[model samples]
Each structure stands twice: as structure tokens, then as C-alpha cells.
Target chain A: MTVKLYRYLEDAAGRWPDKIAVQEVDGSFITYRELDRLSDRMRDRLVELGIRPGDRVGFWIRKSIDAVATIFGVLKAGAAYVPMDPTAPPTRNNYILADCGVAVIVIENRFEPMLIAEPSAQGAYPAILVIGGAGGGVHLRAMLDEKDRHAEAPSAVSAPVRPEDLAFVLYTSGSTGRPKGVQLSHLNAVSFVEWCAEIFALLPTDRFSSHAPFHFDLSVFDIFSAAKHGGTLVLIGEEVGKQPLELAHLIADLEITIWYSAPSILSLMAQFGELESRNFSSLRFVLFAGEVFPVAHLRSLVKYWPHPRYFNLYGPTETNVCTFYEVPTPIPEDRTEPMPIGKVCSHLEGILIDADGRAVEKGTEGELCIRGSGVTRGYWNLPEQSRKCFVEVAGATYYRTGDIAKEEPSGNLRYLGRSDRMIKKRGFRVELGEIEVCLYRHTGVREAAVVALADDTLGMRVHAHVVSKDGRTLSLIEMKTFCSEHIPIYMIPDRFSFHPSLPKTSTDKVDYQTLKFWSGG
Target chain B: MTHESSAMSIVKEFILDEFLPGEEPSRLTPTTALVSTGILDSLATLKLVTFLEQTFDIQVKAHEADEEHLNTLHTICELVDSKR
Candidate 1:
């Protein structure tokens, strides 16, 4: 059966026209009919702007009802949506816009100043649709006002959006310092969305809490799965999500039934949010991904919200949650190691291959490789990097997830850290090579090594060890200032140490193990 | 010491000892912007919040843990006093 991603929104709106489709933390709600009508107008406007099939549309807005509407509208217009984090450094946002060759950008007026100040903003796109006020671009309100002049909703476009067409592109850090966009097709997203609907057994009565940012892959399930099942999606704003206590209260106050976020956020709530005192009777499921939840913290979370079904999902953004493990009710006391990521989803297949390209036997450690409908098409423009990761294995194309894993006898996969320099900090996949490249941009830095120092609370903190040039000195203030200008605030190293020279391995490469140890010292 | 005065001292000591180790305690005052100045990032702010909750026996609501409430030494002391 042919499927388009927008069909989820259309089907839900048809089934439950008056149901609350999306809700913001500030008590704003959009009914299914309103969501449908607004997105239809947006789709007409996009088509009018010459956004054709297979074109890329970008969004740099915060989580709001308009953001959700824009996503569905882009899909309906037969173009893929690219979401850039509004809080990301302007440099990063501009790079993504240029890299994707976005045909149009939908941005909020508050973000217009940052966009205008970006050096890469000059002629980056042909058009910009400002969400709030008039700002050097087409005002979205004007477009909707023009549409309102017509008595009926605009007729659906005849643009052919096949299942294999691009749906959205999510950018993740690459080892080469430039962010690479992972392209997911309509089929890829729909497979996961359908599987989620089946597994979660969602209904119109369910209320889904969306805690991940719009740019994060976790939001894909939060948006599409809820839309597909006709469930109300309550968006937890970034500021609210940051406050563990506020987030806990939101869950309780909204009676959110299905909750999804990073383990670090849940850990904070369990530790500091007084979760035990809250009533989560309406909460039925708690889903976490991006990083391994420390078993101790997981146990504590269970103690507080024991009635909810807890699941640990595992996958990079490329595959959008291919594996999951349901935390057994009454977690065993002797469980010491981090929770297992469990078996592959019903719609996907996973394999563990050793260093020599041979499939390792069960219980042997090897790189996790996934091949299935959920796997993304590949990186947006980097063919070389895409070819390196997406390879043909036994005649089937597989995305080589650089993660190391071992399969248990019970068919569960135990995650052993990454095989490369990529680490998850605060549920964000960070490439150490990316930070090293930023450090090298400084003239006074000769060598730089970045490592992750694991923390129970923050998941992991980045520490940078650098070697100064022959006659230069480096200060924390200077280094931080330079990094903040080039990268996102989250990617900035938490701690910095300067040395005359870095420890080198026998192969003459920087000894990251030594740096990690020295960081402890 | 008065409750507010002791709370301020506790916050000051923690900031000096944890974030600005070995630095002169006089470097920071009640109105210094710890967050905007990059002295405390997201993780550090969380750490500071946990410290405040434990040391002052006050609950720093997640919303109150942001820059508006905890950016300065004085604001942090005020948050603690209000919660207490």
C-alpha cells in the first residue's frame, strides 16, 4: 500500500475533527479541524511559492502550534521539511540552510534578527515565510489572511508524493566537523509510526507529551505517532523541559499518558523533582532514548512512577529507534549493568559484525548494523561519508551504526560504547572530532583532544585538553569565546586544560585514553 | 547569622569552591550574573540547583532554576529564602 506522511494528519483530522490535536505549554490548544485547515492553507501557500515535489523547506521556529502545522503542510506540499534548532549557533543554522539548498524557510519573527545577522544569510534561500510579523520576508499571517478571503479550504494539490519520496532531513554531528543531514523517506518514517501505533496501542483518549526538540529525531515519533493515532500531543517547551520540577508538574497537570524524552531529563526529575509526591495516575508509558539510563537512576524512576510502562529505545538519528527494551516490572535488585537495548523492532533487522566484516557469533562484541525499512536513505549531500556508512551487506544495504553491541542469549542487545569518537552528552550525539577541529581553528592551538567525562546527572560532560603553539598561551576565556562563536553552546567543552604537548599512542595518534585519565586527575 | 545572610554565604561559598576554585572569594558579589557570564552552563546550573536544594533545604522549582531566578548570587539567595 502506498503511503504519504501527511496522510496521518488527514486521517486523524477526519476521524476526530474536534479532538485536541496539539497543545502548547502556555495552555494553547489546536483542534484537529483547526490543524487541518491551517496546514491546508500553508500547503497552498508553499505550492504558490513554487515549492514542488522533492524540494526542501526549512523551519527555524521554536516548538509551537505553528511549527507543528508547518511540518504537516510541508509534507502535504510534497516537499521535505528541515528543522534547524532555533537556539543553535547562527553559524550552524546558516550552514544547514546552504547545505540543504532550502527553497523556503519558515521562521518566527523573534528569530529574524539572528537570521539577518548570520554571515551565511545573504541569498541563502529564495523566500522566507515569517511566522509572526513582517520581517524581510513573506508574513505567514498575510498568507493565512489571504486564504481566509476564500470561503472554502483550498483544493488539494495533485503533486505526487510517493512513499519513497523524502519526508524530512535531520542534521547530526559528523566526524569531519560539518553536520550531515540524514534523509528519511515517507516509507521510513511511516514504518516507525505504524509500529509505534501498534506497540503503544494508542487511542484518542491518550495524551502524548513531546519533550524533545523539533530538530531531534525523537520528535518524529512524538509528532507522527500521536497524529497517526489521533492522540493529543502536548508540547513541553524547552524552558519547561529544562526545569525537571516543572516538567513533572506538566505531566501530572496535563495527565499526559505517553511521555518521551532523554534519560538525563528523567534522571533529573527522579532526583530533584519530588516525583514521589506527584500523581502520575494518568501516565501509562515513559519512553527514553539517546543515552543509556544509569540503572540506579532507572530504579529510582520506577520507584516514583511504578505504574507506567518504561522503555529504553536505542538507535542513532539515521534509523529513528530501531531497537527497544521494556523495563520489566519490579526491576531485579541485582541488575548492575546499564539496561539492555533489547532486540530489534518487528519492522527492522539488526546484526553484529566483527572488525573483519564477518558476522560475529551471539554473545560476541561487534559493531551494530541495521538494515530495514526504518533506515534512512543516507546523508543529504556528502556522498563519500554516506558511502562509508551505508554499505551493501549480503546484497542488502545496511547502515553501519558505529555503536558496539553484544547480543545476549535471550536475544537482547547490550550496548557497549561507540566504536568511534562519537559520544552522547545530554542526549545529543556529539562528535569529538568536531570539537577538535574547532579547537584547531585557533592559531595558538597546536593539538587538541576532546573527551567525554561521564556524569550521573548530565549523562556526560565534554573536556578539552589542548597543546599550545611554541610561543603562545591559551586561557579558558579566550578558548570559550572562540568556541561559542563557532559551535552551539551545548557543544562547548565544559572543562579546558592546556599542556605543552599531548600524550601520543604508539601509532602517533593522540592518546584519548590518557586524556580521559588525565581529565580525572 | 540571619537566614538570608547565611543562605547568601552558603551560595557564595559553593560558587567559590566549586566553579571558581582557588579564586578570591571577593571576585563575586550578590548581583553578579553567573549564567550570562558563562560561569555556569546548563550542567553547572543543574549542579548549583541540586546544591541549593540540599544545602538550604529548599526546593528550586525547575522554572525557578533558570537565569531569572538563579543568575546572580542575590537572586539565588532570594530564591532560597522565599522557598524556606
Candidate 2:
């Protein structure tokens, strides 16, 4: 239990001091020795800034090599890192920062305005470490550049941390008006990372692609897998990552041996990335998760890159990849149904139960619950929410997945549907109720209902229906601008419809089935 | 209006209709950074590309659909014209 997540990097540094640790594609590369030294210096700077053990440190900067080092640096300081989406609305970011009460924040200078909106009530704002030519704040470059500062760093060891200590917190959409932070301990994450290393047979020679943002749970696998095995992680920035062609080229040029990202990205690369002319022979394993990949697009990817083994990873942020499906190569032409989320991962336990919380027979659909090493300790600062997530069945507690699933005779779990209003839009989990909550807060809005519909290009689309308090039609433009200033852009409704009244069920709840039918979903 | 001006108008209208519903068309200038300014995420970019392809009767290549070419309104116009 003494071994925490940061030990992987420390151990890797010892084994492969000269090997490349983290690289920015077509930009710069840092060796394991440099990363170790930089992280140690970063740890020293954080400790000097009064970041104590178990303190949460916020990272609001874009993904870069320095950010990678900063992650380990915070870990070495015996603190948990909380990452906020740099592109999210200022209000959303401020809410998360205020909710977590982070001791310090690392941000790019350009976002000073966004941080300015934070309410000045929390006993002095978090100390800032700005990345770009720090103005009135400590320079992040000072932590990475070791020429003069390394001599100033203290040789004192940081406080000891246990495996159960907090490692990182990831915030996901909540049914309430605000987002909820999912707290994962070092044990929670280290166990999942170790399981991936074992299941994937990760090697020191493998080159992993860091496609997901650090705030996402998906990024945990990319960073720790490389650290644990002394592999190289090539960080892909947002600009290149958003461009299908550039990302496809990066996979080839960087010689990414292991490619892990959402199925949306893979589908994009397959559709418009000009994959026919691209080279993907270096890809040894390709993994996709978060949302279902349409079989057609997945088939096209298989056609072009038939060399790499494809895997479908399934899990929520609460449990890091509890189950996964290994796609059979050369998908049979007539296979219409998408592959099932395969057997539960060896490290975790899955249970399917009915609405009454009783175990269901095989082939009967029920909610999927997971328990074991990867299940998080709970949500940050929300004891009630945490306690509600667990239900004791037959004397063992399991975290409810909120997903409906059927157990096939072959032991694989077939994902049927969701029991809640949650949906994944472009790999980001969004709760429709959250959008409704935002709309309800709008002045003169009497009622709001939101639903997600499947889309060919965008993975899924959000549609919102609203009723005006005065029965006057609401301006679509004003509504959109209102939403843009409040919620993250991804959660914004693609289209808004006005109705004097919405259809309701006998229980007086808005009928989402009617909405979905009207949407032709 | 000339065909060029008409093309500009059409593109502006589409941008307002899809991405920036309430924003003034004049504010979205030719030099505005569409992709970098957080207006056009990957989903928005795909929709814009489809609009350009279907409306302009041209095909946008993979490399042409990058930030370098699609970041600015001017660059997007240039990309569409070149494809035509």
C-alpha cells in the first residue's frame, strides 16, 4: 500500500533514464531523466507554495509536456490533481474550482481573464503558476528548466503517501444543476493501470498516444501505462487531435504502437482522414471506448488497418474500464449488430439486477453494477451522493452503473441501453437533466426538456424543447447565447424547439419517448 | 450581389444558423479565428465542411480541413474557392 501512482514514473526513470518519456508530436521530446528531474523540481515548487498532502491542485492549461510533468509533480507533492476543461465556459470552470477548493492552480497566461471571474471568498485565491511569460505570477518554465532552479530545490523528501491516498479527481455531468467530481485514489487508479499493463501486455518498446485530455479518465491509461512500463507517450494537442487527417498522420509519423481513443475519433479518421493512402502498420493495438462505434465506420477502419487488434473498452468514470471486448478481426461482412462489451475485466466484478435491485436471470436485461479494484472511493465532497451509488446485494456492496445490459450465454455483457437520461456526446458524458436544469434557470422559461439523438457525423446530437412562462415565443438566438455563457459548449443544444406545452406521462413527467420519436431517433 | 459576395453571405448565414445563432454577422469578420476562438469544435467543423461541400459543389480534402485552412473566415472562403 506504500506504493502510490507516482512510483511508476520514479521506477521508470530508474530503468530508462535515457529513453524518451513524453513527447509533443513534431515539437519537443523529454527523456525519462529530464521528466523525473522536472517533476521533482515541480514537486519542490508546489511544496514551497504551501500545497500540503491531500490538497487538490487545479490544472486549467492545455495538454503539453509541461502539463505531463506537472501531473507527476503534484503527485510527488502528495496531492491530488483536479483538471478543468480549458475551453469550457468561465462560469463552469469557476464552479468546479470553487467546489473543490484547490490549494493552487497551474494555468496558461491567456486564461487569466477566466480565472478572474472566480468569487474572491475562498480565503485568498489559489497561487498561480502561469505557463506563458508569467505576469505577476510564478513562471511554470521556472519549474521545468533546471539550469538555475535545480540548485535551489530542497533535498528533503516529500511526505509519505499510501496506495489509498487520493490521486486525481475527474468531474462529470450531474443530474443536478452543477457538475460532480468523481474522486479516485492511488489504489483505484494504480490497480486499473496495472490491469491494463497485464491485459495488454504493455512493453517498454511500445509508444502510446495521449489523445484524451488529462481531465478525462481515459488519459489515466495513457500516462500511467507509459510510466509503469518505460514506454513513450506522444501527446497530441487539441488542434491536431481535432483534425482527422493530422491525427491519422500523427499515428503513422509518431509510430504510435498503441492507439487508444474514443470510437468517435476512430470513426472520424476512418471517414474523412483519407485512410486509404495512410500507413498504419505500426499500430499494434487499437482501443476505442466511451461510446458505441457504428459497425460501418468501424468496419472501414478494419479494412484499411487490418494489422492491429481492435478492442472495445467499456466503463464509466467511476470505474476505469471494468469490461472490454476484443473485436474479432476481419469483421464478418454480414455482421449487423455492434460487438458486445465482452466479459468483465478480471480485476472487477459485474452484476445485472432488475429495478427491484434483485439479480436477474441470464438474457434478461437489467442494470449493470460493478465492484472491485477500479471502483472509485466516491465523489468529492458529496457523501450523500457517494453513499447512494452503492447498494449491498447478498452482503457485498457494488456501485450502480446506470446502464442496462444483458448477459449473453458466452459470458459477455451486451450493452442494451441506459436507465437514466445520461448520454455520451462525442465521448463526453452529458446528462440531459443538466441541460434542462440550465434552461430552467433562464428567466421566463417555464419548462425545459432535453434529449439526445443519434447522429451519423457527431456521434450524437442534443435537442432541447422549452416552454415560455408568458407563452411568448423565445428567441432561439438569445437562448443559444444564454446557454453558451453558462454550460460547456459540448452540452449546448444543437437545436431548440418552442412549445406551449410538452407531452407528459400519467405521473406528470415529460415523456422522453415522445420527444425521441419526434426527433426520429 | 456578385457571385463572390453571395458566397460570403451564404457562408455567414450558415455560420449564424448553426454555430453562432444570436451573434451579429458583421462581428464574424473575414479575419476571425473560427476554430481557435472556440466557435468551431470538431463537430462544428464537420458540419461546416458538409455545408461547404454540399452548397459549393466541391470536395474538401483531408489536409484542407485543418486549422490552417479552416481557422479563419478568409481561409475558409479561400479553401472553398480553391475546391471549386
Top candidate (DockQ):
2
Which parts of model 2 are misplaced by more than 4 Å?
A: A117-124, A133-139, A143-153, A469-477, B1-7, B13-44, B50-84
lDDT of candidate 2 at residue A298, scale 0 to 100: 93
Q: iRMS value of model 1?
A: 3.5
Clash pairs (backbone) in predicted model 2: none
Model 1 misplaced regions, further than 4 Å? A116-124, A133-143, A146-158, A470-478, B1-14, B22-43, B46-61, B71-84
Cα distance off (Å), candidate 2, residue A129: 1.8
Question: Can you write out model 1's per-residue Cα lDDT over A262-341, one digit (the tens) per residue?
Answer: 89989888887789777999999999999989888888889888898999999999999999999997777788789899
Candidate that would win on lDDT: 2
- What is the Å distance of residue A485 in model 1 from its true position? 2.8
For residue A42, model 1's alpha carbon misses the true position, in angstroms, by 0.7
